[model samples]
Target: MKQLILAEKPSVAKDLSRVLGANQKHKNYYEGPKVIVTWALGHLLGLKMPEDLNKEWQTWKMETLPMIPKQIGIKPLPKTGHQLKAIKQLAQRKDVSEAVIATDAGREGELVARWILEWVRFDKPAKRLWISSQTDKAIKAGFANLQPAKAYDNLYQSAIARSKADWLVGLNVTRALTVKYQDNLSAGRVQTPTLALVRQQERKIETFRPQTYYVISLEVGEERGKRVQANPYEIKDQQTAQGIVQQLGNGRVDSIVEKAKTESAPLPYDLTEIQREANQRFNFSAKKTLSLVQSLYETHKIVTYPRTDSKYLTQDMKATMRERLQAVADFSPEVKTYIKNGAVVQQKAVFNDAKVSDHHALLPTEQKANYAKLTSDEQRIYNLIVSRFLMLFAAPHKKVQQKVTVKFGKEQFIFTQNKIVEAGWKTSEEQRASTIQWQEGMTVAPNFSIKKELTSPPKPLNEGTLLGKMEKFSLGTPATRAEIIEKLIKSELMERTPAGLQVSPKGKQLLELVNPSLVSPDLTEKWEKQLEAIAKGQFSSKAFLQQIEEDTKQLVKEVKQSEQKYQDFSLTQKKCPECGEFLREKNTRDGKIYVCSSAECSYRRRKDPKLSNHRCPQCHKKMEIIEGKNGAFFRCKFDGITEKLPTKNEKKKKMTKQEERRLMKKYSQEEPQESPLAAALKAAMEKQ
Candidate 1:
């Protein structure tokens, strides 16, 4: 029987088709003598929304919130309904007795395929095609050793449990908070925790106390080179730094302790590691870098998977290394030259079969990349992956150490330097260009030594270093880390200052208003551990989900009981005319708006006035409905008035007949709140 192959994405489908002799391609379909392959557009099926559960839940009502259904339902989105139809049709084909799952070999990938099969009611026995890279050799080898689908039941279970739990907790809690707070606010278990992290950083910076620290440096001479300044770690206290410098008295030699140490070559670049380094060196946000890498992988087809977490390859990948390197080397001439030596560098750090999970670290696909077709950004990202791939097969960089000791006053000081012996495994030209070198067991003589005093505080956390911190805490996976950071900035929980991310006052207020446990990184780490356990079959998904449900309930109860007042950032003095309630103007993803104090009354006015033609006569511009402590009023166009008649701009210049007609036509076609740019600009100019 011909096998029906399901791939997670079009790119994977294309690669698999080429290797399976299924070169006869159709629109969204590929076929061969023995196999018919198709693909998934990420997810063709997803959990039903709150409105899908019941019509009553559509409106935001406090009584209708916390709508946890007995069983979460799944359905295809209307936009992609046909894709689901195609999948089901293929599943029931008479010639297709069994199927192969060639989706991404990860937790989410497992879920993607399983959900489709379940939805289509496919009862046929199934096989799995698990391979990290999409090279012809890897695909052939995977086909040669296909495993029964039953082998990954635990993985599917874990994925399902995660989806169900998210549905139960995220939807229910998000609805509950929106209704209870009488605002359009929403939250999820993962999202809330992520927000809390950003808010915490903001709080730290806002309340930070700057204290001067110290660092000691010296103008030291190399044996054969001129003098240069060396930078070392800072000492926090000025007093302590001064004492150390004074102890040095006149120039004196310091003792150096130098020992030979070999750093194993770094494992191949995983998505997270690459994102971190890119963020550090290029000042690229994690999200931007991921986008760039994704473009190279999908559009240019130069790099391997960009969403992978693994940093090492399985044993089977070794056979295909030469071909993969050849393709990358061809695009980057430097890489091509290194591999021409006919020597492959193999290090445990880069190719530990034991450490590899579903997918390996990102690498170049065996398909040669067409450099001229790539954009400059794509080339930069592609080059990064290419250089990283070439370095894996070069020798480990070796270095020598030198040490010298000198006594200055009661304190005995020491100095050391390192010299590179060889740049192994990373001998490519790019590698050499990026590498930093130092000599070991080396120190300056008395005449060359000088005492310097320094003081500085700890450096603020930047995107690069903060990413490293998040990695250590296992805050989120490589695929999700960038998104978390992006959300924080977009939501205004954290602001990027000159130094680094600073928590905003609004962020601090949110933490105080919500449960502390909801925002803790420990919660995320604990959940990740449990998810991994579920994936491994070591833990039960049911039990894990039960824990999430319990956590959600506790969080809701705490928020309800807490009496702490939220510091409303939109501190306006205007009152609502409808109910004489306090008016609050708030910013949203799109723009800002004014809402009434009563949560039950969904009275909201958009900040944009282009949609509405209403205008303030005083300013002769559209006036947005704003709430403050003052009584309900349409503030003046040029100056705000309390519950009084509208006014116009004092500086309003006389308009020509044509201008007047154009203005009239524009107002007739719009709403007072729909034209934000015009209203805001006119308001500012009129005020001046």
Candidate 2:
């Protein structure tokens, strides 16, 4: 009898199949004598929609909302029905005696596989395969010690509860707001709170008032002729600052004191921390950073799991420290010298069992990296992980921190300097400190000056700062934070600018419309705490879901009762053909479209420029086809050129079948002639 194995995606399935010796490939699975392997394309099934649960919930009416189903059901996604059918058939085959759930080892991964098992009704006993990396050795070891499927029941229950809660709250509140406001608006347990955070930052920027301040500085020299600068105090009044500067014609060094200090290396990257750093250093979006790291984990097999929250390694992984160090040292010769000199030390800061969760911090795996295969962004991220890992084994940076006080006619000024004692783990040139010398009681008269400045407002929220705020408030899980940001952008509530993320007018309006409880991050934090407990088997999923159901009812009622009005900012002058109502301009992923303002009317028209495969003769770029009072024409935005399309009567002179065949044969044999019309037709056919 064969043991069937299921994975979360085709890439992972291929890895498992290679390790399991499943050589024979079927249409949707790989089979060997003893095991058959198949995979899911992420989630093949999702929770049933509200309309699917009850026919009455089909229309967007306020009365139909708060539609909670007693038993939430699941259905296979329409697009992936074929793959689901193959998995179902494979599970029920007479030769298959048992199943192995080899999807990702996280809650979402467990849900992906278990939902399929439920929909397929696979009765056979099942086991779970949990592994952190996609390395062949890890896969082999994982398969050798698979755990009983029942062990992860709590995790699956937690996932189910989270999904159902999101559905109940997200769908109900979204519908209520849309129905009451007569505009397309959405709210969620996590996304709304995140948006509120952005709006909060924007409010600060809007209300901020800048104040002018002044500082008096004195430059004093030591016995060795070395100079030191000091800004002793800040004066809020410009007149006071000028008075002090004038009284102090010059400054003399009064005293010098020195103290030694050491700074430990920063902890390794958690998913959120890495996302923040990537955004700050590379200007990469949170989603882009997540995608790059995920590829490094699953595709390159060079890094450990990417969607982890822990910043330290578990104690058990301590045994592999030397091997991991060696792997990282292979990339840099300086790192190699450090390792060769026995610099790798077992530090508690790097390894602690208590801090680790389902996965450890992001680290370079023991696998040797092939830098050539990685993209530029991947190379940068890999270097960051490896650098952090190397620092864990190196010594702390040491320096001498010095503070000097100088006096100018009763007023005192202070100057601070840092002298590096040792480079230690800080190998970067910027971190290296230069030396400054000073002697106690050595004094010399020096220059004085007054500087004027204004207090600046808090900077706008960028993807990095926004992620930091989310992490601070426990707003969302590391796995879901990037997606929340993307959702806000897609909903047109937030926009990206060089300054940072800015709240649109509609976003401010959303905050005004949403209830305080719904917009507070505390709500999400409390739910996450409960979700964690449920995963640990300390809480009940049923009870948590019941709470969500009650919360949804109250939330919908508050939205319905809101006396606030919504202004249609997107309204256009165009009138709907079906109903005499003003049309509103809406931007979709494909392009912009104008829809009727009347909720009852379904009239909509595309307003974006129509893209055609016609090539422009001047710039060799695609031209846009436009319709005007003069009939059809092609316009090239690149070169500001326009050409009228041939009239139908003028275009009636067509080529014979033999001539067409001859032209096709000539084009196939060589590159097409570079004529305006011919090139356009060639580009169009190539697109087809």
Q: Best candidate, TM-score-wise? A: 2
Model 1, range 366-398, lDDT digits (tens) per residue? 888887798776777777777777777666677
| Cα-based lDDT at residue 121, candidate 1 | 94
Taken over the whole model, the C-alpha lDDT of each candidate is 0.71, 0.85
Candidate 1: stretches off by over 4 Å: 10-33, 54-68, 213-258, 330-341, 423-463, 487-506, 570-688
Per-model root-mean-square deviation over C-alphas: 12.5, 7.7
Please write out the lDDT profile of model 2 over residues 1-688, one tens digit for every residue. 9999999999888878888899998889999889999999999999999878888988889888789889989998889999999999999899999999999888899999999999999999999998878888788888999999999999999999989989998999889888888788888998898999988988898899988877665644422222233532346887886776666555566788889998888888999999999999999999999999989989999998899889988767766776777777667667777667665553457778888878889998888889889999999999889888877777788888777777666776677776778777776635424244556665546566667778889899999999999998887789889999999999988899999998877787888888789999988889988998999999999999999999999998899889998886888888888899999988787689888888788987679667777689889898887766677789998888998776777667756678899999988999655889888999999999
What would the TM-score be for candidate 2 when compared with the true structure? 0.88
Weakest lDDT window of 10 consecutive positions for candidate 1: 429-438
For each candidate in turn, the TM-score is 0.75, 0.88
Best by lDDT: 2
